[model samples]
Target: MTQHLHTQADLDRALGELTLRDPRLAPLLALTGMPALRRREPGFAGLASTICGQQLSTHAAAAIWARLSAAVTPLDAERIRRARTDRLGRLGLSAAKIRTLKAIAGEVMKGHLDLDELAGAPADEAHARLIALHGIGPWTADIYLLFCLGHGDAWPAGDLAVQEAIRIAFVLPTRPGTKETIALGDAWRPWRGAAAHLFWAYYKLAKAPGFAAAPALAPVEAGTEPATKPARNPNADRRSRPEAKPAASERLKRAKP
Candidate 1:
């Protein structure tokens, strides 16, 4: 069965289980404490919002999302499909983002992609499906799985913060590359998503001015591809922040079963 970190309790349970699976994480957890559950609206709107945040700062992303949402009525696939490119551009979306959004909307309407169905799918499967889309990259796919769908097994191996955190915690000579990061995450297994949350929190603390450093260990060289792909948006270095809330009219309503 797949695990979902939909609430604080779910995250706590996963973290506990993860600590048991790998005792090294115990100290990291002790340093950082429990992380908060960060969730977004699920379905097409959620995916679109993720796209909007790509390659942009949290404040910039939130501002653009707010303007876009206020301008687009209902803020769904149908609206996106019917919206003009120039209008979307005027709402602060770049041409590339506009194209990506339109492509995703078209897929959703054509039944080629089912955003909601991916929620119950395994993290890897869901990730593969998402990355297969025109402009969605590994980071976007993993983020959607972990944050939007709350898939507990989603491993964001390409995240720079996670890689840096791992280097600091494990006392590596350098930040591990994407492939090395994936290999290291194998130990965490089904709780890798929780580990991701833990590491993100730890990253913040570890970078703090007076935080105690991890004990020195044998240096391991992680020579492989860079932590993130060149195609991915580069603005993910900052800690994840909440996106702007959509207007009441743009909020997603529960779909009928």
Candidate 2:
């Protein structure tokens, strides 16, 4: 197994090796050249932000948080805990999200969720604990580990942005789902999260040269998930999303026996 690649130098070396292995990855190599890996404090606030960002666009998430921070004067557990549901809702949170925030705050305040212990726990253990909460899911936990905790080997397999970026880069016939992205990204290994960041950055850069970005999605509630979608580009996009409009998750649903 690969040990966690710590430090910016390790990421730099791995990216360099991959690009050299395949000249095709030149753009990725350029965009992510020795990027400063963001390291953040792992705690209730970080995890909560991860949950808030799920399925929402970056602009939308940021806006909501700005509003939320202002709404709750102190912006801590007690403030969120005592907040009325309507108050949170007014800040652009959905009914589901209100419960999620409340649960997280409650758990932390009640001493059920331990931010310090979680920081040191194994990835799997941390993931499991997060999922036990009311609204935390795999994608949310994965992102927390990847960006907030700065876990070297974390991957948000279900992130839409990763799928879309991979599609655009490789120019495939269809959009790659979580499972598909995971398989294709297997070669990236321990540096996959950084790979994800590079792909996201590339998505932004790719849209710069008159390539239309994906349609503007409606503003999501304050704390929501967002998956990024990239428009087709020949130099990139090894695969394509099966349908023109990415299939809606619930719309693709089935009954459980």
Which candidate comes out best when scored by lDDT? Answer: 1
* Residue pairs in clash, model 1: none
For candidate 2, the per-residue lDDT at 113 reads 83
> lDDT tens digits, residues 1-257, model 1?
56799999999999898766556677788878899988998888889999999989999999999999999978999999999999999989999999999999999999999988988876767777788899998898888889999988888888999998977776665677776676566566677799999999989998889986745211122222222222222332222211323321111111111
Question: After superposing candidate 2, which stretches have Cα over 4 Å from the reference?
Answer: 1-14, 17-27, 31-41, 122-125, 210-257
All models, RMSD in angstroms: 13.4, 12.0
lDDT of 2: 0.61
Scored against the true structure, residue 37 in model 1 reaches a CA lDDT of: 83
Q: After superposition, how far is residue 156 of candidate 2 from its true place, in Å?
A: 1.7
